[model samples]
Structures are given as C-alpha cells and as structure tokens.
Target: MFGVEARALMLEGVNELADAVQVTMGPKGRNVVIELSYGTPKITKDGVTVARSMAFENRVKNVGAALVKQVANATNAVAGDGTTLATVLARSIFAEGTKSVAAGMNAMDLRRGMNMAVDTVVEYLKSKAKTISTPTEYAQVASISANGDAEVGDLVAKALEKVGKEGVITISEGKTLENELEVIDGLKLDRGYLLTNFITNTRTQKCELDDPLILVHEKKISEASKLKPLLQLVVKLQRPLFIVADDVVGEALTALVVNKVRAGLKVCVIKAPGFGSYRIDHLLDFVALTGSKLISESTSLKLEDVTVEMLGNAKKIIVTKDDTIILGAVGDKQVIQERRDEVTSQLKKATAKFDKEKLEQRLSRLSGGVAVIKVGGASDVEISEKKDRVVDALNSARAAAYEGIVPGGGVALLQASRELDKIKTTNFEEKVGVQIIQIAMKIPAYIIAANAGYEASMVVGKLLEKIENDSFGFDAAQGEYVDMFKAGIVDPVKVLRRAIQDAVSVSTLLTTTEAVVYPNYTSNSNSNLHYN
Candidate 1:
C-alpha cells in the first residue's frame, strides 16, 4: 500500500494500540485483564506489558501496533517507568503527522520540526528538574510509578536505602504471603555460567554450589591437561569447583562437562566480567573478595601448579543464565578494606567521565551490598502483577536518584509544550510540524485527567493559565489544582526525556512511512507470518 490509504490503515493500528495502552496511564488508570495462552488470565497496569500483549487481525494495522510497541519497549528498556507516556506521545504524533501528510505537507520537514520540538522539551525538562536524594523523595517517586501503592513505594525506598543507588536490586516471588526485603552480604556479576549443562538445580535453572572452591584464572584454559591437577585436588577434597576465567573452551570445557555428566563432578565455569584491563581489575576485586590468588601470566603462578590454598572459598554461589551471585564470600576483612581503599583512591584521581563511572560502580559493588525484594500475593497472577509494579518502582527510584525529577501528573510535559511556541521554524510545513508536537505534548496531561473522570480540557486550560508556576497542575486524585511537587507528585527527568525522544523517533518514522509489507497467509496455508 502507498500514500493516504496506507497511512490511514497504519493510523488505525496506532489508535487501536494507543487506546488500549493509554487507559493504564495515571494513578487512577484502570487495570487491563489479558488472557494468556495457558493458565489463568493475567491482570496488569504496566504499559509495556499491555502493549506487548496487543495484536490486530489486519496485517497493516499490526505493523502500526508493532511500531508503538517498539516505543514502549524502548522506553521500558532505557528509562523503565514511562512506557505508557511514550505510547501516548507516539500515537498523538503519528495521528497528527498523518493528517498533515494527507493534507500535502512534506513528511521529512515535519519530522525535522518534531525533532527540534522534542529537543527543546528535553532541555526544558532538564532545566526545570530538581535533584532528589533523600529516602522520602525516593518513596514519593516510587509510589507514583507503582500507581499510588504506598506499600510498594516504601519497600522500594527501603531497598534503595540499603543497597545504594549503584547496587543491584532484584525482584522475585516471596515464599510467604507478606512482601519481604533481604539485604545480602554478597556481590553480583552480570556474567553467568557458560553452559546450561553445568546447572545443578533444574527448578530454578541455576548452577548451585555449596562451599565452593573458586578458581580465578586470568587466561583462557583451552587444554584440559592444565586443569588436571586442580580437578584432582578438588575431587579428593570432595568440594565443588567454580571456575572464573577469561574463557574456558575447547578440550577443557568438554572435559569438565563430561566429568559432570558421567562422573557426577560438581563443577561450573563462567567467563570473567568486563574486558581487557577492566577485566583484570574486576578479577582482582573478585580475588580480594574471595581471598583467592589470581592465576595470571603476570604472576609466576601457573594453572597446573596452583594449590588448594590459592583457591578462593565461598559459603554459596548461585549462577543463572544472565547473572551470578556470590553469597558470604570468605575473605579477610583487612584485605577487602585495603582493596576498597585502593579503588577509592583511583576513583578520586580518575579524570574521564567513563572511568569515573566504572570506578564508582566498582566502589559500590565493593562496599554496597545486594538487595532482594520478594513480592507476595495470594495467587500466581497477583504475585506476577505486583512483581511488575515493584520492578517499575525500583527502576523509577534509581532513575530519579541519578538525574533528579520533575513535576508529575504530566504537568512537566504540559508546561514544556509552551516552550515549543518559541522555537523558530524555517518553513510553514516545519512550523506545522512544531505545532503538531505542541498539541501532542498536551495529550498526556489530557488523557491523565480524562482517565480520572475530570474534564480534560478544563484541567488543561486551567493549568495552562497558571503556566507561570511550572510545577502547578491539576491533582486529579483530590479533584483540585495544586503544586505537584508539594503534593508529592513527581517523575524522573530521565524517564520523561527518554520517552519524548523515543516517541518522536519511532512516531516520525511511522508518520513518513508510505508503504508496508506483510506475508499473505491463506486459511489452509501452513505458512507462518511473524511480526517482531
């Protein structure tokens, strides 16, 4: 399809998806009940989840829906809490852009204008953002993201208080009916076991080792011969062996797998974290944490000559497909503290922003512990939904901590739209494009008010009249206008910034698209048409 007809079909798709997703937008947004392929139906208020579950029978419409889904997914991946807002923005942009294009406006010029407007709004948001650091501020942001759930908000704040901003916080199902938070004296790595065959627990799909002897190798172990002596010693001692190396491949990996399958040898191998010199620094940190010596070419130590005393010991280690957690690492406190001080010194001297960030992360991992939030509910469906909220809350809190926050309830974007009028455009079409975005920016605040049973136009009009106070807006929950920040209503600046940028990126591409293609599957045909 080409021209107006194609764009019209795509707009139908955009509207269909936006309509379903926008309902779950604000504090009072309604939950969407999605039927699953198996088991009970899933109920959620998560915008990304709702967007992902949507599908249209019409292929062209599905393409439109998929494009909106991309915006939601990208927002979720980058900023975590603004997926719904991103969808709302995308729908509005494409809807308005489609009409402009149908009326003979240049799509490219319009896109350029939209981009310019988005850039201005993003800068405006950054300028108006207030940095938040206290636990109370963290809870406020979390609560709003969790759809006004105070308990989830408190839990997230407490987790961040315990784990620090850079530390890892993981969400899982609770064993009991009450939500619980656990702070572990452990370290988490992004790297996991190299192969699933090393897994010992089928239920969790993890490789679990108890009182494991950790081997920290700086170089690859390609030959099984170099590992023979260490393997023999571990087997004789009847202890599980956990290997962290640059890479474990070829004959060495094969031998380990064969021994694990046939001889019931408890062993697992994972590639060390980071790369190049960074990898060496991470290995040194790991070694210091575990009281293990590094088997490196820099040292006189060789793999075959390594003794049991040189190996690190841990109370327990859990290895999953994407990450690993080391619990109760057995290392000397003084040595760990020394390593911590060294990293601190290096961090203070670091000049580059990237180097400083990496150093900060290492310092956090060294001193800051890991936190686990166990979400609880009466049923599997309830637990799943609550877990999603918890995750969103956590992510929002982290983002707020990093880049500060702005007025919530869409007041930030609503006020930012006013700045678009000041943006000078080169042509009438470009000016129209800027006008389109200016109107689109108001939609979030409008839908948020409309969803709460208030007259959206009245709320938006009143807010615009009071635009001098950037933080002033309608508090739909209370049915009154108030300062959003004073009312504890806030959103991470990063979330809002990313949402606008991503929405414009995908929506403008969609607005300018003159063609779409899909497989024509007949009723009796076995051909599978998949749209990703």
Candidate 2:
C-alpha cells in the first residue's frame, strides 16, 4: 500500500473545507465558521479560510501544501461563494487526470483542460456583473455589504458621487460637510470698543459704510468717517466686503444700523450680536441666529458651520447690525468676487465626473438577474457552520457529478451511486468512478441536515423520498420553498443544476483528458486521505 503523502493530505483537507460551504453560494443557502482561537474567537465560514486552516493542521512535513494553500487562499479571497467552485473544479480535474495518467495520458493535457474550465466559470461571472458607471454605484456596492453605520454609508456614497462628478473631493478639518446643517463662530452685543478691555463709553461703537468694504477689525465711526475720499475710490470696485470687530454696540446704535440685505454683498461678522456682553451663552445663541452656513472650532459648530470652500473665499468682510467694521476688503477682493461665477463653474466641472444619465443607464442594466434571499440570522459562528455543510454538499455534488454539486456527500457519495443504479458502462473502473460519484452527489444534503442537528442518514433518506414523488423543482424555481420534508423535492438534485453548464464542461473535459495533477494549496491538511 502506498503511504499517504503530506501533499495528498493537504489536498484532501482543501477538499473538505471547500466541500463544507459549496452548497450555500446561492440565495437559499447558509454560511459556515470554525473557531480556533479563544476570547471572542474569530470566525468565518469562507471556504478558503477553513481549508487553509485545515491544511496547516494536517500537513506535518509540508510537502508543498503551499499549492493547497494557494488554492484555499484564492478561494477564500473570493469569499465562500466561489471557493467551492474552485475546489470542485480542481478536484474534478484531478480525478479524471489521475485516470489518464494511469493510462499513459499526459497530465499536462488534463491541466490545460482544467484551465479552460476555470476560464469558463469566470466568463459566467463576468457575464452576470453590472457595468459600474458612476461613483454612486461603486459606493452603493461597497456599502451594500458593510457592517458600519448608516452615516458612513452616506459619506461613502456622497464622496463617490462627488468624485464621480468632480476629479477629487477635498476634505477639510474646520468644517466637515455632511447632510446635516451646522454653524460655528459668533459675536455678541451691548459692549464697548475692546471686547476684552473696559468700555463704559457707548458713543464710539458704530461705523458707517459708503464704499461698503467689510472691516475685519473694529473701527470707530470717528476714525472711519475720515475715509470719505477713500470710500468713493473703493466702493465702485465691484468686490465682496468683509467686516471684523473688536467691541459691542450700546443702546443707541440700533437706530444707526446699516448692513442691509439689499447690497448682495457677502459679509463675515466675527464678533457680532453678543460682543462685549457680560453673558457668554448669548454668543452661542448668536451663532444659531445666523441663517448662512458658518463653521468654527472655537465656538458652537452647529451655529458656526463653515465649510472649507467658504473659508477659502472669505476676505476682510465683516458687517454686523452692531456697526464696528462695516466694510473692508482683504487684498484685491474685487478680482475674486467679480469672477466668482467663473471660478465656481470651473470647480463644479472637476468635482463630479459621472453624468446622471450614464448612472441611470448603468442602473437600468443592473436591475435584472438579481436574486436577494434573506438567510437565517444565526450567530456568525452558527451561520458559518451551516454554510460549511451546504458547501460540502455542493462540492461533493461537483466531485460526484464531475462538474456540479450532486445530491450528497460521504454517504454513498453521488456520481458513483447514480451510475451504479442507472447509467451502464462496460469498463469496471469507469463504472466504479461513476458509482461512487453518485453517492457523493447527495453528500451535501446529508451534511446540511446533520449540521442542522438532524441524523444525517435519516435526513438524507427523507430528502430522496421527497425527490422520488413530485415536481418540487419547478416550485423551488418559483420562489416557493419545497420543504423536502413536507414536499417531495427532497433528493437535493435540485441544487445539482445551479452550475450545470459548468458541470458539463468540466466533466467532459476531465473525462476526455483523463490525467490528474497535484493541486496547489497549503491552508490545511486532511486526516482522512482517500485514494483508489
């Protein structure tokens, strides 16, 4: 008897791991998990993870279980959905190729055939994918399977959409823009010239605007009135104004106030309504008072909500109902303010790349061929275990059918049993392969039932009983649950058709080539190594 090498053990482990989750890839299936660590142990039902871990445990000598590792790694990287496909395809190639090798056929021919089969599977997936056009769709797909908060999803979607529209979206620390409205810095009233200094005098509080330039700092009316010649020269510049302040207004200035809404000039009032006041809460209230978006770090952000772009355009423009610095310009404000439309239009052009119509067209294409079935919300670990059972069934089916998930696992296998019971063949070994494959076909159903906490043999027996009786396959396709226990579609053969095209191609190629080559995977090793 030839001794089982570590390589063979690892390959078998990959087989088992993939076998564990193959059946659950479709809508009606489940997930699987394995807990190797403690203290809120990590868990996953992904085929590659289980197979890799299994390979690591079984191969002591490491006779290139690395290839086994590779297979499991690739499978797991794809998530459990496609790992089963990878394993089943690999195993089928091996099965047929091994036969060919024994019969003096080239193993390379079998590998080439297997490669073709893998390509076919990929082609199928590619055909099923939706063309991504806009960042919104990209964000949608990313957020669809996320575990984070709703706001995070919104951020991602918005960012992607913005990037789709614009070349890049710039983020700022001062005011992070979100869907919610916010405010920032503010000022108060009823005080004198200096905010921090003493101020019993109320006469020097107000400043007038002729050539309305926003003042960033406080300027008394006495000092500002002398700029009569300066006023006429600056007002006609066609520029935006910013007014800053140092102190508050007295009781009499309410009658003398100026910065009206008719000017169409954007103003930035730093210390406004609450300035020079004894109370601080009113300053916060003043922030909430402003209708325009303000953003700040020092004051209440809700009221000071200033975005990055807002700050970028801000000049020495501050004008409050309290007349301190009524009008002032920050370095050639006329140049930017006059050309604001050109700047905004240019920025908007680079911000979002995706056209709305293109996005809609892509969405239209993705609308069909989508089947979203909710699975049992079991614990992550529980989901993993159950999924494993399903995958095992699918892989067993694939191994047995030589191309697809059959209706069984270890118990009588599938293809072998089917051939033994139905298909006739003159070659004894060929008949034997088919016979065992038949029993393997149903291995998954048995495993799923057992994992679901039922007796494997009895559960599978019932499944077959149901399949022998009715047209439940049609019912299942129509979204009707054919409870094999309740309805007669129990044999699990219904699952064997999901990848029929795959099965036909792989099976025919493998049979035609009849040469098996070693698989490359190192994730786990098998305790039970079966060889014929």
Candidate 3:
C-alpha cells in the first residue's frame, strides 16, 4: 500500500516538474535561473540535468525527485536532445497507471499489455521512411525550418555540399551557433580549384617550410614559387614579402610590413623556415613576436592531427598583409593540385546564395551526395525541442536542425499506462503500449498540424481512417495542418507510433510482479495539482 501510493505520489511530483521543464528543451528553450531558498543556485532547461540537481526531503519521500531525474537522464541519452518530452511522458503514464492500480486492477497484467502496444507503434514508424539521394531537399528543409537569422539560409545549403550530410557538423550551445559561421566570398580561388592535400600520418609534430622555391606536396602561396601562374598576381598587389628560407636576408619581411600596414597590408611571410613544413608552435610564437599575421597549415601527410583537430584539414594557409586565413581541411590534410570534377567549382560558390539548379550542378560535379535538414517552431522552446524530434523522425539521416517539443524517452513507462486503459488482457500490455504511444506521439503530430493551422481532431480522424483501410501513409502532423500535405515527408506522429509499439514489445518485460507493495503509499498525492 505504501509503495503504490508513494509511486503514485512520485508520479504526480514528476508531472509537476515535467510541466515546468518540457517547454524549454531546445535552443529557443526557456531560460530558468532560480535562487533556491536553502540550496545551491541553479539554471538550465535540460530535463535530466535539472531533475538530478533536485533533492529535498519532503513528505513524498523523494519519489517525485527520483522520477524526474530518471526521465531527464533517459531523454538526454536517446536523442542528444528532447528533455521535456521525457518528463511529460513518464509522468503521464505513471499518473494514469496509478489510477487503475488504486482501483485494484492487476499491475503486472496491465504492464504486460501496455508493453505489447508500444511494440506495435515502433514497428509502424520504421515502415514509413525511405532513403534519399541528393542533399538539396535536406538542406532546404533544415534551413527553412531552423529559427533565427534567416540570413544563414544560403550558407547552410552550401556547406552541406562541402561537408556532406554526415560531416556538415555545427558547433552550437543550446541551438545558437557559437562560432558565428559566415561564408567568406572575398578570398575567391576564381581558378575554380584550391589545391587539396591530405595528411594521413603525423600527429602533433611541427611543420617546417624549408625552401623558398622548393615547395612541399601542398599548394599554398607560402610554398608555391613566384614562377607559378597562380601566384603571379601577388606581385601586382605590390605587398612587401618575407619568404622564410634558410634565414631572413635582413629585416625584409618587416620592411614590407612597415610599408604595407599603411596600405592595409600588415605583414606577409611565406614560410619563415622556407616554404615547407613549419611548426604551429613557431607560427604562434612568430605571430606573437612580430605582431604580424601568421598562417598555420600541415604539409605533413598525416590525417590524424589534421582530421582530428577541429581546424586541421586545411589545404590553403594564407598569411597576407592584413588578415591571416586558413582554408580547406586542417589537421586531416589533403592536397590535390589538379582540379577534379567540381571541387574548385563548388568551392567557388560556397559563400553565395544557392540557386537550386546552380547548387545541383555544383554538387553533382562531385561523385558523392550531400544533405541538410532544418526544423521550424513557433517559439524558442518549440523550435529547440522540435529539432530533436525531427532528427529522431529522420533518424540516421545526415546532419539536421529543427525546433519543437521532444517525444518522451522512457517509452516503457507510458506503454504500461496503455495496458491499464485497454479493454483486454491477452496481449493487453502490448495493445495498450501502442495506444499510449499513439497518444503521446500526438504531441508532435497535433502541433505540427496546428502550427500549420490545422484542426487536430479532423486530421487524426483521417489518419485513423487510413489505418483502418490499411493504407500506406499515416495520421501525420502535417496532414492535420493540410497545408504541408503536398510534402512527401512522413509525419513525426507516424514515426513515433512505430517506435512506441516496438519498445513495448521489449519494455513490458521489465515490469515487476508483486503480491502487494503499497502499505506505506500516500493516499493524497493528486488532490489539487494545477495543469497549467
């Protein structure tokens, strides 16, 4: 009696916290910084983090707190996102299941039936997805869908081609880009190709440029000879040049900096140690030494450091009179002087606004395909959480970005709730798990529809109708909105339904069976909790 009541009471408390946290799971999630009355100050929207941080001795005996942390931790693990959905789903299932348990229903039987239901849902979601070819559509979906700074629309699309769907990684803190990635158009290769040199060996050794005219395997102006056609134009710029060879002839590089700084040319050094391998430590020291711009790149053929380091796989390292820039791969180095199908061509337009045909042409120039995904939401929280849901919906697809609420993670708990509500007991656990998933998936399904201004009930009816007819599609979120119907993409609701069913099949087995375990349970956990 006590455990039952305590579990129920904990469920209620979990719901309360979930309610507070679910709405703030993404980049646009709510910012909460609370100064507690008697504990450490706290802040964050991650459901799991916040839940774990909470610990106060209360009448509920920490049941509520324990549940909150479980849901939070679960949410973070599955999706790299989706904090709030975990909370809401866990609490909702417990809340509903406790009612039946209190009414004297068999807990094990209900748990089993619910698990069966969730299994059905998971299988359903898997059947709906199809593989893609080009990355253009993916890029568009992500760009158009992501919130804030509409200006990044073009940049996002172009980078997709360069990085590929899987490689087009974004570094962000809570949905906002930390590095402020902007496309650079000023340093155009115009020749249609900027050399590619791959460093497949060396790890953390210093790169030295040993010769003035004898170039290393890579194709940077620092190593390329004055005789090379690509660098003939540098003479036209009339910038003082210090090509680091055996040693400095005099203050040659400095003299150039003196004249060039006034003309917007600060300092230009090819390879202070000739134009070959130069030390990064040396580069940094020299930059600090001369207060002049220093460029760092590995002529070494090792991919470990270049590919491993965030900025290593670069092919072109430019230390000009004004700003110092590194282009292409860095630590993971690749050098190709010969132009290929369209690497140079694509690199030429990496900073430009994408024209569907133009981008298609440029990317097609390369043999491999590219993809991009963007998610949209009504507000910050909506956008952030929805992004995770979209990623989950498009699981295993290329890098994606979106905004909206998360679907729950500890789906097993919710599946249990389904059995309690089911009319049968044979595959009762399995059957009910399906229903709970169907209902929970409703979170994203209805919202996606509602955001498009659709009537949720009507869309749901249509989907159910489809299910009855054994039709291929589903009661998708966009289907409810009606506006997004033309898009061939399956709805998030359908995807989750499949996942829920599959999970229940496996998850229900975890439900513990006992004669009785609630003698000390509370009798008053849900008397007057507010929903809003």
Candidate 4:
C-alpha cells in the first residue's frame, strides 16, 4: 500500500488503539477489563498495559497499532509514567500529519516543523518546572501518577524519605491486605552473575545465597590453582560463596561452574561494577562495607594467598542478570561511616559531571539505604494492578525530584501549545506541522475531561481562556477549573518531555512513510517459520 490509502489505514489503527487507551487517562478514568489466556481477566487503568494487550486482525492496521505501542513502551522505559499521554499524543500527531500529507503537504517539511514545535514545547516545560524536595511534594506527585490514590502516595513518600533521592526503591507484592514499607541496609551493584548456571531460583532467574561469604578481587582469575583453596575453604565452612571480580575465565570459571553443578556447592560469580578507576573505587567501597580485604596488586595480596578471614560476610545476596543486591552486610558501622565521609569529601571536590555523579552514587549506596514497598490487595489480579501503579508512582516521584514538575492534568502541554505560535516556519507545510502539534497538545486535557463525563470542549475552552495563568486547568474529578499545582495535580517535566519526544519520533516516521510491507503467507507453507 502507498500514499493516502496506507496512511489512512494506519491512522484508523492509531485511532482504535488511542481510543481504548485515552479513557484510562485521569483519576476518574475507567478501568479496562482485558480477557486473559488463563486465570482471571485483568482489569487495569494503566495505558501501556491496555496498549500491550491490543492486536488487530488487519495487518496494515496492526502495523500502525504496533508503532503506537512502541511509543508507549519507550515512554514507559524512560519516564516510567505518562505512557497513556504519549499514546494519545502520538495518535493526534500522526492523524493530523496524515491529513496534512493528504492535502499535498510535504511530509519531510511537516516532520521538520513537528520536531521544531516539540523542541520548543520541551524547553517551555523545563522553564516552567518547579523542583520538589519535600516529602509532601513527593506524595502529591505520587498520588497524581497513581490515579489519585492517597494511600499509595503516602507509602511512596515514606519510601522515598527512607531511601533518599539517589537511592533504590523497589515494589513487590505483599502477603497482607495492607501495603507495607520496609527499609534495609543494603548495597546494589550494576553487575550480575557471569553465568546462568549460578542462578539458584529458576522462577525468578536469580541466584540467592543465605549468609554468603563474599570474595572481592581486583583482578581476573584465570587459573584453577588460585581458586581451589577458596573453594575448599568455603566447602569446609559449609557456607555459600559470592565472588565479585574483575573477570573470571578459563579454568577458574569452569571449576566454579562444575562445583556448582556437580559438587552442589552454593556459589555465584559476578563481574565487578564500573570500569578503570571507577571500578577500583566501587570495589574499595564494597570492601569497606563488607569488612573484606581488597585483593589488589598494590596491597601485595595474591588470589592463592587469600584466606577465609579475608572474605566479606553478608546475611543475604541476590544476583540477577543485570544487577546484584547485598542485604544485611556484616560491616562495622565506624568503617562504613568513614567510607561514606570519604566519598562525601570526594564529591565536594569533584569537578567533572561524570565523576560527581559516580561519587554521589557511591555516597547514596553507603548512606542513603534501600526501601521496599510491598503493595497489597485482596486478590492476585488486584495486587498485580496495584503494584503496577505503585511502580509507576515511585518512578515518577524520582523523576520529579531529578528534573522537577509542571502543572498536570494536561495543562502544561496545552500551555506549551501556545509557545508554538512564536516559532518561525520556513514553509506552509512546516507551519502546518506546528499547527498539528499545537492542536495535538490540547487533546490530552480534552480527553481527560471527557473521560470524567464532562463536556470536553467547554473544559478545554475555559482553560484556554486562562492561558495567561499557565497552571489553571480543568479539575475533572471536581468539575471545576483550578490551579493544577496548588490542587496537587502535577507531572514530572522529565515524563512530559520524554512522552512528547517519543510520541513525535515514531508518529512523524509513520507520517512520512509512503508504503508498508508485510508477509504473504500461503497454504502449504512451512509449519515452522524463522525470522532474522
């Protein structure tokens, strides 16, 4: 297919997907009941979840739906929220772009103009963003992201307070009816186990060890002789051993894998975090935290000469494909504090942004602590749904802390649309692109109002009348116009900016496309198929 016909079919698909997703846009938005392949049907207000569940029988339309789905996923991956808004924006932009193209507008010029408008909107959002530092501010952001769940907001606020801005906050299902938050002393590393054979929990794809003896090595271990003594010592002690090393290869890695598989020894190996000087600093931090000796050439410590006393101890160690978390580390408080102080001192003196960030991460790991929010519900499906919301809220809270926030309920985007009028366009096609985005920005607030059973156009018009006050927006739940920020309705600038960026990126590509190709399956084709 080519030209208007192809674009029209794609736009229809975009509309179908967006129509289902936009309903779940605001606090008063309706929940979508999704039929599952097994067990109970899933009911959720998460836009990305709804988008992921949708498929079309028409291949051409399915292609369009898939592109919109990519926008949602990309937004989710970056900002962890605003996926619904991203989908809505993508559909609006592509639909408008399609109309312009059909009217003899240059597709490339439209794309260029769309990019310019988006960049301007992003800058406007940044200028208008307000940095949030207090726990109350965090709760407000969390509450809005979780669809006005005050309980979730409170839990997330508590979690962020306990963990600090740079610290890790994870969400999990709880055993009880009430949500719970727990703070623990732990260290998380970016590196994970070197081999899948080290995984002890197949269900979670993680290697979990209880009361493990941690061995921190600064250099690679390639010989069996150097590892034999440590294995023997761990076996004699009857304790699981966790190895953090520069690299484990050749006979040394093979020996550990064989011991894990055949000898039934509980052992896991992971590469040390960071690179070069950063790696050494991270290893040093780990050593200080675990009360282990740093096996480095500068210290004249050889792998063969390592003893049980040199190993660090931890209450529990969990290793996954991309990360490792050590909980309840058995380190002296004084030593850990001293290490933290050293990192703090270095952080103050660091001039490079990269170095400062790395130092801040070290300090956070040493002092900020870790928080786990266990989301609870009456049923499995309820728990799953709530957990998703909690995770999104937590991520949004973090993003808000990083890049600040803007008036939400789509007011920010609507106001941003006004700035597009100031942008200079070289051609009529380019001007149409700017107009497309200008119109698209208003769609979110409109859909949000319509979802709450109000007259969408009236709400949008009233809000636009007060464009001078950028924060003024329709409070759909209360059927009133209010200051969004003062009403505790806000969005992270990072989320909003990313949503628009990803939406326009994919939507413009779809707008410019002249043709699409799909497979032509026929009778008597091979039962098994392969793709590359």
Candidate with best TM-score: 1
Instruction: List model 4 lDDT by residue over 1-532, tens digit each.
Output: 8889888988889999999998888989888899999999999989999999999998889999999999999898768898999999999999899988898889999999999999999999999999999999999999998998989998999988888876767688999999999887688888988999999999999999999999999999999998998999999999999999999999999999999889899999999999988899989889988989999898898888889889999999999999888998888789989998898888888888678768877887887478889988899999988987898899899899989999989999889999999999899999999999999899989998998999899989988889999788878888888888889999999999999999999999999999988775656677744321
Q: Which sequence of candidate numbers ranks them by lDDT, best first?
A: 4, 1, 3, 2
Model 1, span 1-532: residue lDDT tens: 7778888998899898899999988888999999999989999999999999999998899888998899999898768789999999999999999999999999999999999999899999999889998889999999999988889999999989888886767799997888999988689998989999999999999999999999999999999999889889988999999999999999999989998998889999999999878999999999998989999888778999989999999999999999988998988889888988999899889888679778877887788489889999999999999998998999899889878999999899888999998999889989998988899889988998999999999999999999999779887777889888988889999999989899999999998998887777667658776432
**What pairs collide in candidate 1?**
none
Candidate 4: minimum summed lDDT over ten consecutive residues — where? 523-532
lDDT of 3 by residue, 1-532 (tens): 2446555556556556665665443223454555557745555444455566566555463555564555455444433333445455555555555555666666676676555545544443344333334444443333222321233333454555555543323322233432133333112111111101111112522121111111121233322223233123333433222232233223433333433444433222333321233233233323222223332234333212222111112234344222333333222112122222234454456554333333333233222222334444445544554444344333212323221111112222223333334444465444543354446544533333343455746655555444322222222322322222223232233223323332233223222312222224345764554321
After the best TM-score superposition of candidate 3, give how far the Cα of residue 426 lies from its true spot, in angstroms: 3.3
Rank order by TM-score, top first?
A: 1, 4, 3, 2
> Where is model 3 poorest over a 10-residue stretch in terms of lDDT?
189-198
Regions more than 4 Å wrong, model 2 = 1-7, 20-33, 41-44, 56-66, 75-81, 120-532
Better of 1 and 3 by TM-score: 1
In the range 123-167, model 2's lDDT, one tens digit per residue, is 433332233344333332222112112333344344434323222
* Candidate 3 displacement at residue 256 in angstroms: 21
User: lDDT of each model, Cα atoms only?
Assistant: 0.90, 0.34, 0.37, 0.90
lDDT of 4 at 527: 75
TM-score of each: 0.77, 0.32, 0.46, 0.76
The candidate 2 region of ten consecutive residues with least summed lDDT is 365-374
Give candidates' CA RMSD values in order.
Answer: 7.1, 18.7, 14.2, 7.7
lDDT of 4: 0.90
